[model samples]
Target: MRFRIKKVINNNILCVTDADGSEMIVTGRGLGFGHKVGEQVDSASVQKTYRMTNPTVQQKLLDLLEQIPYEHFLLTDELVGEIRKRISYPLNESLLITLADHINFAIKRQKQGLLYKNPLLEPIRECYPEEFKMGRYCIKRIKEKLSVSLPEDEAGFIALHIVNAELNTSMSVMNDITRFVDGCIKVIESYYGKKFDHTSLAFSRLAVHLRFFAQRLFQNGQDSGKEEYDKKFRSLIARNCKEHYQCAETVAAYAENVWHKKVSDEEILFMAIHLKRVNLSEQHSD
Candidate 1:
């Protein structure tokens, strides 16, 4: 508990030495209340100690802490480290950081009766109407629980996780599933020169698989169980695309090439034959 103050530089600044032989510049109105340059400073009112972990965040942390009012709670350094560990993609890292920041800010804003309006609302309507609906649903859940509105992207990702979660996958594993989904979406977009819509029956079924993925993430605590969930989701996506969709074999060939897997021509021919039979016979047994 014994600490020494070396110098009182100004009204609020003081040089202090701790019992552990560490010296730091202490700045606060309370620091120099009665303590002079050569006097001992009280150990109380020590808000926090700052030491850089990455050294890259040194400037950023200093800048933020200086301007950003200290909130009741914040994103833990452990959570940030976990994100950087689980995701290697730079885009994902930045997105996850923003997500964490939003969560931190939302908690602080709740006290002021302020709710975050989603800036992504228009974009979600134009670019992802289907996901937007699901996002709205997730927001309803949050609202019912906390009476606070969340931004669309947060709701969207939460819904995506909810829809994608299966009973056997962990969050870390679901992250990979989402990464793969992004890759699949890219390939589909490139082949068709248009974004895929979840409004279609085939895509709707695929979205169901994503929901199962979300279920898995929240339920499954085991790391090894993720592959089972992803395997089911991948198979579900493929099955919906092949059986329920009217996409051309030419399009099928594109997916085959992108996924580096062989999709048999029988898949398309069988779907066509089965569809024709169902149209003509109207018999479930047939």
Candidate 2:
């Protein structure tokens, strides 16, 4: 199976077209050496081929690979492979581009003594435990391979990348989700007149719940329907957890006002319960 070279990125990477006219990014040492467009590439020598089926995503991958060090690119590829095996959900191919870009930047930052701390690291870890664990594994691998010691916050960032990939949402929507979760946190903190220790398990659990709640809102576009049982439970919360229920209402109101979307009563109920636990812990600590 021969491929026609379309463009040579470097001696180790090139873009080629298969017999079916499908474009692929081929990688192999010396594969693109002295290669010219329209030249025949021996498929046997190609070490790996990534389908350039999505033009936008593939172009982003090309752009990122072009800037990243070759060794780092290989490391990122291995990390992605490990993550794929460990996680249950199917990750999008776009993880290749985004995760590569992130890992490359992370290494560069660590080397330069300039690490951007993830403010939501605790929340991210709490919300996506499995992904966060995978992120830790990824960081460990990076340290072993690159000798770059990164902070735990980097693990949270990686987890967010994995979660973003699993959701198959665009980067923009992922950003919105992050912002929404932050807003919800602020609402909770403001109502209680205190900052929740972000590293606290309770805070992390709340963060995780809010992340999924935000995902549901963005995915379905609205709070559509509530089952009779759910309505009853929500009402029960309103009756019993009065203070917690009010805090939830404040959060729901803030989300609705800013995003112009309705928050389901069911969401308010769960959030109130979560908030109740957090507030109770704070009181106990005091």
Highest lDDT: which candidate?
2
lDDT of each: 0.45, 0.84
**Top candidate, metric TM-score:** 2
What is the per-residue lDDT of model 1 for residues 89-195, given as tens digits with 9 covering 90 to 100?
Answer: 22222322333344556656765767656543443343334544645664565466455666555665543333232223444554554554444444434644655
| Model 1: worst 10 consecutive residues (lDDT sum) | 88-97
Q: Over the stretch 159-196, how does candidate 2's per-residue lDDT look in tens digits?
A: 88998988888667876787788788878889888887
TM-score of each: 0.32, 0.74
Q: What is every candidate's alpha-carbon RMSD to the true fold?
A: 12.8, 4.7
**Where does model 1 exceed 4 Å of error?**
1-135, 206-286
lDDT of 1 at 196: 50
Identify the runs in model 2 with alpha carbons over 4 angstroms from their true place.
Answer: 170-209, 218-220, 223-254, 257-261, 265-286
Q: What's model 1's TM-score?
A: 0.32
* Deviation (Å) of 125 in candidate 2: 2.3
